[model samples]
Target chain A: MSQIDEQLRTELQRQGVWVTSMQDLYNWGRKNSIWPLQFGLACCAIEMIATAASRYDIARFGGEVFRPSPRQADLMIVAGTVTKKMAPQIVRLFNQMADPKYVIAMGACAISGGPFKQGYNVLKGIDRYIPVDVYIPGCPPRPEALLHAFMELQRKIDEQKLTGADKAEFLKPDQPSEFPVPRFGRHDLEPRANPNVFQPPVLER
Target chain B: MSATIETLEAMERPPVSMASRLQGELLEVSMGPQHPSTHGVFRMNVALEGEIVRKLKPVFGYLHRNHEKIGENTSYLGSMPYTDRLDYFCSMTNNWAYALSVEKLAGIEVPERAEYLRVILAELTRLQNHASLLGFLLSDMGAWGTPLMYAFREREKILDLFESLAGSRMMCDYMRFGGCRVDPSDEWLAQAKQIAERFPKFLDEFEDLILGNEIVIGRTQNVGKLSAELAVNAGITGPMLRACGVNYDIRKVDGYGFYPRFKFRIPLGEHGDTYDRLMMRALEMRESVQILKQAFAQVQPGPVMNPKAKIRAFRPPVGEAYGHIEAPKGELGFYLISDGSPNPYRYRVRPPSFINLTILEDMCLGHTVADVMVILGSVDIVMGEVDR
Candidate 1:
């Protein structure tokens, strides 16, 4: 019965009626092995560290392999307030990361500039510049909340459609040519390439 | 015999030209606005001549959240949580400092019991901050996370107590303008006392593990010297200054809260090198334990906040006040100007790390590149505090 079951399964795979498509396998592999970059910008970074520590143990979700280098990481957990000064570097790091990469903006600051929203220096939201896959909200969200975000990212990956070559722009096999890196001006990051989009309204008398 | 000894010293050192003596070109190295060892986005631009560092410059503002500016924008009560992000490690002390200034400005009085509670929580914050400082110091020393994890283990217990009382772990935001947000039960205080009693034992074990080790000794001793005179002139306060044998703790001088009654020694270091800074933190934790024990005993049953003061709607007269405390890092001060308004006329944080970081180049010169990490770790500048 064991041998027959094995042969039947193999034959089923050989025919059109199989376990799953190569796309599903690829998605599954990418989803489970989501390696995050070791990046922290502020108070939330402490919570991130606690999550990685013994008690919370992010290793359970396969995110324990925190790559210090962006080149090796498949995910970026922007763990704190991304300020105007730090925004360019954050975008640069995102640009450096390889394909099939995902970005999870993980805190109030990352989500919508947080308690420091009134502050001029803090960026309004990370998603305003780079594309954000998921956003976790809290004034430095608890580690469990971040873990939940990771789970949501996993679900998002599981739900992706990848077949017939009509792929999502983000799902394209080729690495993005370049993320428009912002340059520092007098007060803020000027995405000069996309001028009109980010320009503030001119005050009228 | 003196002439012969002088002749021998001169023979040992060949008289070389000053140009030849300083021959090698210096190499520039940027440690971080983002790197593992700089301890949260602090940048140290260094000039290295061969292995030895010729100059160092600390560049901050990467993690600046515009804390002072935001403080001015928000109401006095709204600024409490922002203080938590100041040092990020010593949230309790930061909250207390901010609250103390607001209380002074508004002429609001905190109840007697609230002062004891503040002392109790402040000591606990010191314990945890110093514990994690040890962890980070050892991590910077390249022991990876062995001692670091042990320190975190001890810190986790203190954080658990905080989480139960304050709702958040790192950013407690529990302090109010009049008093505090929550008062722990008898059971909670008893448990906190238990943890405080157990801290000294953990400190002892921690010291036995890494304090006297040869590698720690070699890397730390007689390295990154900041003389007591220079420390005073540079406005360096807290453990870094105290580590230089200057017993200038604000708790003792200003005698804030119940610090006057408590019995604790101001631990000082002879050399003020990296080793002394590490040892000073270890010693300070013991002092905090003693203070916590006293607070646990003396914390009497009374009202937590003054009945006269309305917390939600507080408006102060036209005046300015500066409230300061011996934060675990250094002297954290909050200067507030009130023009009889709910919002402060101007809000300023005299951040310890930001001021303390001015001496980085002074400390790092004449040491090797590796010692740069040692010195920076010794300084213990949280990028949040420095840039804020």
Candidate 2:
């Protein structure tokens, strides 16, 4: 609608030529249309739902489409307490997500296991297994806090370069795209590639 | 525990090849730890014969963060926030339950004003919780977020009040051992009184929207009936028990706090079906409004906390105490063992959600798989409490 845009379009149409960086277009598309998995783990999940509700609608940021299936989603908002029982499933869900996916560690629990950090069952943070794009801090962050994390994630996404190993990580066909899903065994088994964790018997039999 | 259709097929192929009798066998399905309908991180291993459920096994601990273990290791005051996460929707009642246990352990008496404040907040919590339940129950039945949004609208007002009072909406660790953390200013009281007065109009609107729906009635009525005797045997308490026509309410039985001073009725249901469970909550919200009105009016000038109550390094006598209260869900109790130390020797929470869910398989015995959600929703198990 602007004068320069009309001229550029006409000129580009006439010449059948356009100029733009690959990374800019890719990041622009990814940043604006993040689809969060329709997943919630604990107390912070309530706030996450509140954000999805009418008051602080995440749709404004194009993050409201909560895909029940992880395969369809691009963002995983690790919303609440990740216990040992849930850690494997969380890893599986993350691995099932398609290439070019992002994860936002949403609260104190997902960031550092929160007040439950002292507990035996809690994982210290989710990033020990999966890469995190953003970390929002609060016992359970407010809806606004989550929105700020969204901004932070968007900013991080915008900073990528279409060169170097990072570029190959996103663009290459042969690059690895999955992590070994943790499994239940004698003690909980970590994903094969990740270091094994020691289970401390915190309570007496 | 959700497996994609692809994964489900992959799962079925191996088992189906081994068994030739498909006509007489039950299909096993795992629903949730990450479902939209389990309320929170809860999973049910359901075996189905056609549409009817043959067996139900709820596999929990997915949300277990060891609340009691951490509480036992921390200072008395440090555990308040952890309690909020257990039954996250009913944080006020959770706070009061733990505070009551500590108060009992220390033999510390709460002031009149604080008792009145606790009653107000607890009742408000009940109103919001039941409202939320109704919203979610209807959603589980396949109506859209219209009812839930309206419920959230009412709940958001209460959350705003909580935010003003305790600095956080959902996790309000507002209650202390002998009293509340902050006394209500006159302005706060006036606003709360206004909300309490206006809440009935919202309830009337909610009742109008939900009570007459044919879909709700047909789906819920006589769907998941639990007999009174069986429910009692299962140790099922709270609204689930009341729905079976049991007259037991901890407020009336134990007479904790100033419950006896306040005049209110316990809403009981005739049949222990999902419909009755739903009605019990709506009816109880009316009763909560009654208590709130009385509590707000009767609150007088007094110290919020007893003068002798200390904040830190609180040492109780070497003994144990079990303090129970009629939380919105059911009988919420805290069992604490003190060794005359700053930290409790042992801390155990008698979570109502966890106990109420004990009857899930019993209730789901003959019902269709669809009704399982209704029964579980009716039970209202927050996994934070269940797994903790």
Candidate 3:
């Protein structure tokens, strides 16, 4: 008690109040209940099924329950190649989801279009339209790899200690950044004087 | 049998007027497009008469991504991965069939080691698919999760082997035109051998679990009995045809790769019923184990992929070829036409499941609507391949 009082007095002198009883409830909740939306588009969907099945058991991390609706889901596991035609739909779906949602772009197609990079229909990357929290790099990332993504998300959640009530603002598509564009052209250049009188003098001579 | 539509019309007097008048008597049921048991996005328009199916017309194209068209558009190397997506549950077999066809077109030879590995992987893929399909059949029969879980557990071990060897799991795309993607690493070889070694005991356990069970026999035996004539007419092959007492295995008949070198027995069935098909798959799994064991013992470690071959945007000489394999389902054939381009001009998949559906009406004619699902499951159609 005497030591606590002495430490409290020193801390109080340096700062205002030492409130040391704040529990990491926000992080814990975010870590334990990351609900992924059911958004499978192509071959990666098979691997996604394999991950959710008994062998990989994605349920162990509490994220195996896939929510069909985006509004209820906290995570979006994009499991396949998104075509150009499908990109707007994906963006619209992401926009419909509530705030505080994270995205894990699964497979190379979602990451950077994989082998279909040159294909006219394939999107270059899903991240161009929707923000990705994690990128699983594989042709179709193994189920265990998907689990690692979940674990990484958990680690991120813990590190950030993000509160449920945090009112984070989303950036608009047209909004300019705070950083200024570099000015290469200067406004200090002076205009040159004309030499028309010299030519007239030569002609007179 | 003739088409059910014609038969129903024949039954009515002044058919067109009767058809117009007697519309609501048939109970319409939409079975799929999202129903998990259909194996993919297939929709069945079943006209039923009080739980007895009168006519069932299969509707497809829900999962059709124009895989064949894409195959036509992409080069030989580029098209390899797309083959994996067709009947994705048994991707290695699909990969080999396509690769074999392309290899045939190019007049390329696969090395001995690569051939052995192909056989080993193809057999393993067969075993796993049959086991999984059996489990699925059981699920359709109301033995919900136990059998499916057991099947998946075995599948996981195989997939693990695939992952360690191929650098990817489900969609392996490991087969190249002339050879495979890579030789088996020492660790992978050891693991594959171990899996083969451990498989017989697991198969015995599987037999004990379901084969002797009275409920399984009662549900499956003498159900949907298709004679050898009917099976052949319907273009059934692989285990389904062999089960009907026909010894027409592509490996034995065509003598592909080192299949002629390996000594094995083909399992046959007398009745060609659902029980026979289930039993056929089980026995084939055992045969596959033997093939795997033989391959492991005989195979010499060497290059897995093709050497002195540059597959980048390579065009084939103008020709047409149909390559068929005795896949786990039936005869899976690729009819390819090359116009001296990087890609095939026309690509067609002679899907065994789709053709096998030719006999479905015959099987389901007198059976109940409940048995219809069972029959469909027994056929084991992969809609990706079917619609493609």
Candidate 4:
């Protein structure tokens, strides 16, 4: 089959005739209806509520159905500080989520532990355990910032290939859906960071 | 219900060989750590016989980031922003409580204009907190997001005021030791006054929607009853204590800040049940509006910060001081002991949510598992403060 010219494609679209690949249709449906898990951890969770609420209505982007169960949710917004004690439970929740799930580390705390990084109980970052798709940075990022990150996630989803070596990770059967849940050791969480998920660059002074 | 209570009591204090007379096995259920309605990361270990909750134990420290430990490690000025994360809802009040403690320790005097500004901000914080609490309580009762959306619609206006003046919507670290960080413009004050003027209408609209609803009344009226004696004995404060018909608001008792200058009545409730607790917040929001009106009227042009008070390298005297304020939730107090150093020798927060949760089991006894959610919502335990 010959590739359709841009002018011809435009003419077809104007006439209500649409041309789209299966990958485009799949990504379009997935991106538009990204249902977030109804979970809140700390201060940033309040801002997350604000984003979901009336004024910042996350429903505008079709990402408003905040499912209470991980099985029904497509997005896991780790929306606040992840403490050492709660890290295992968070990881467990993530593992319970179905394939084609994405994680949004929704605050500085979720991204790099924020200001509470110095605290003994605070996990340095949630990315230490599970793979995070989007990282929004702020003490507690405003609702507007959260929406921006959501759009960024959508854009990333839009670019995913259907059939190729670099196809979406969720499409790969060998890709692990679950990560290791850390345990509470004497001083810190056992296996401080997941070797597979986290790779911090070496710093030389 | 009386028979159920009797059976619950009998189960609590089993008589000799009563185990043989007792019915089926009690099922132990842990309700949280990731529940939709536990508020935030709070866990309740509940033992149930059918639908009624027989035994309840609240598990804590899930969201704990060692707040006090962090406060102790950081400098006096450095800990201010962290206070915003404590209650999360009433950051202004948390900042005031901590600042009040540090000022008491250092013996710094807050200016008149600054005091007025603090009053205005605190009352605004109160209004938003109560509105959202009611919304959350209703949502837990299965009203879901309609009421919460209504609450947030009003909350966004107040947050706009905060974002304009204090620089952040939720995390407003605007209070310094002796005064506020920035002075609000006359335009800001006018906008706040307009919001205050319009708040009662929202309350009226909210009441029309929820107050007389059969479902709300049925679910909340007799559920989670707390006796006046138990409330006082368990060290309950804020709206929870007032819900028990106690007239012990710290704003009136301690006369901290400009509260004594303003004329506002403390709303009291009878029956001390979930409905009373819910109504207490509604009534208190009305009182807070009155306070805001007065503070806005009396506020004059002057320095927002006290010139004598130091921000960086702030070291209070070598003595301990405990200062408390009537935060939206309850009596939020901060205790600090300075060692003539930048960081305090000891820093402790007497979080209202944590202390208020002490009587969780007592209130939850004999109630249904669903009622437990409503009761916990009435308690309003923000996990950041509860676990911190």
Best by DockQ: 4
**Tens digit per residue, CA lDDT, model 1, B1-388:** 3543553343334324322445756566677766777788777766667899865666678888898888887788888888998888889999999999888887788888889999999999999888888888888898886777787788889999999999988889888877888788999999999999998888889889899999999999999999999999889999999989998999999998789999999999988899999999999998999999988998888888777777677777899999999999899999999987888999999999888888887788788999889888888878888888
Please tell me which predicted candidate would have the highest TM-score against the true structure.
Answer: 4
- Worst lDDT run of 10 residues, candidate 3 chain B, spans B10-19
Over A61-83, each residue of candidate 1 has an lDDT whose tens digit, in order, gives 88888887889998999988888
- Runs of candidate 2 with Cα error greater than 4 angstroms are A1-29, A158-168, A184-188, A191-205, B1-23
Per-residue accuracy of model 2 over A1-205 as CA lDDT, tens digit each: 1123767767887898764467677788888899999899988888888887768888898898888899999999999999888988998899999988888998999987888887878888887777777899997899999998988888878886667666635567775577666676676545422543223337978
Q: In model 4, where do residues sit more than 4 Å from their true spots?
A: A1-5, B1-22
Distance from true location, Cα of B177 in model 1, Å = 2.5
In order, what fnat does every candidate score? 0.54, 0.77, 0.11, 0.89
Candidate RMSDs in order: 7.0, 6.0, 12.7, 3.3
> DockQ (Cα-based) per candidate?
0.56, 0.62, 0.11, 0.86
Worst 10 residues of 1 chain A by lDDT: A192-201
Q: Ten residues in a row with the worst lDDT in model 4 chain B?
A: B13-22
> After superposing candidate 1, which stretches have Cα over 4 Å from the reference?
A1-29, A158-162, A166-177, A192-205, B1-23
Model 2, B1-388: lDDT tens per residue?
Answer: 2323343343445445413444446688899987878998899887678899866777878988888888988899999888888889999999999999999999999998999999999999999999988988888888867788888888888998999999998999999999999877888988999998999999999889887889999999998899999888877888889999999999999888899998999889999999999999999999999999998889997899888999878888999999999888888999999999999999999988888887787789789998999888888878888888
Residue-by-residue lDDT tens digits, candidate 4, B73-144: 999989999999999998999999999999999999999999998898999999999999999999999999
Question: A-chain TM-score per prediction?
Answer: 0.81, 0.79, 0.69, 0.95
Model 4 per-residue lDDT tens digits across residues A32-61: 999999999998888999999999999999
Q: Per-residue lDDT of B26-142 in model 3, one digit per residue for the tens?
A: 666777643546765566777676778766667765455567767777777888888877777888989888888888887788888999999999998987898888888887887
